[model samples]
Target: DARVTQTPRHKVTEMGQEVTMRCQPILGHNTVFWYRQTMMQGLELLAYFRNRAPLDDSGMPKDRFSAEMPDATLATLKIQPSEPRDSAVYFCASGTRGNTEAFFGQGTRLTVV
Candidate 1:
């Protein structure tokens, strides 16, 4: 079975740095989601796309977070001007909304100093 894969499972950076995390969603899937997990925010939805079209990103911080689907199987999330408050486990998930179970990447644990 195909699965979503992520790179740089762990990342550490100082404040005001740029961080990019990559994800390869399952083949033939068209929906992708970015989520941040923390004790305070819990599991919060950052952004998502369906069939390469952006759906909603109201849960994300507009100034520092960006999510995109550049191709069928590739999705990426980037953060600029990162701060210590950005430390969290960033997860990439993909699925057919309302149809199948979402597949999650191993996750990129980002820590900003």
Candidate 2:
């Protein structure tokens, strides 16, 4: 059962509220990934960090979306003033350094009014 850990498996927030999602990458893993799944856009990679440093997050709304890794094991994604359009299943995955196989965690399903 080696996998990433995500908290608050589901969340319902009012529009304009802030939401934060958390993940604990597998121990010793140096790469973490975040993704979002939606009806229209399908599945898209939002951002990723290697060695706990963000490579790029252009796919996300720069003003509203943020991703960070406070340490090797923990990664976080936050949405400020959340909107209904932001409702989606957010997934967190991790892999060993330079490894291609990623282990995914049970996603956090977010709903905004």
Candidate 3:
């Protein structure tokens, strides 16, 4: 079945630690997105990619957070020196280039203590 698969479904880390999350998008999908969900912000789009090229990442903190699509099927999001404020559910989604319907992964819940 075609699905978006995310790894490390839950994570707990101390402040100043590094966190890495991975996602495998469904085959044939050309667009991918990284999102962070918080009670206050709701679902915020952190990064966007089409055909494995990053089109926007302005919502992400450039100093500490990064999103990349290393290959056609692999996407990654990393946070360095994570702070408690970064705690949230990170989601990976994929869809076709011209489609509005996106398939979301289960998400990776992160807690920085």
What's the C-alpha lDDT at position 4 in model 2?
91
Candidate 2: segments with Cα more than 4 A from true spot: none
Tens digits of per-residue lDDT, candidate 3, 29-104, equal 9999999999999999999999999999999999999988889989999999899999999999999977989999
14-86, model 1: which lDDT tens digit per residue?
9999999999988888889888999897988899899988889998889998888888878889999899999
Q: Write the per-residue lDDT of candidate 2 for residues 8-109, one digit (tens) a residue.
A: 799999999999999999998899999999899988999989999999787789999999999887899999989999999999999977579889999999
Q: After TM-score superposition, what is the CA distance of residue 45 in candidate 2 from its true location, in Å?
A: 0.4
**Model 1, global lDDT:** 0.90
Q: On TM-score, who's better, 1 or 2?
A: 2
Query: In order, what lDDT does every prediction score?
Result: 0.90, 0.93, 0.96
Each prediction's total of clashing residue pairs, residues at least 3 apart in sequence or on different chains, is 0, 0, 0
**Candidate 1 accuracy as TM-score:** 0.94
Candidate with better lDDT, 1 vs 3: 3
TM-score of each: 0.94, 0.96, 0.97
lDDT of 3: 0.96
Order the candidates by TM-score, highest first: 3, 2, 1
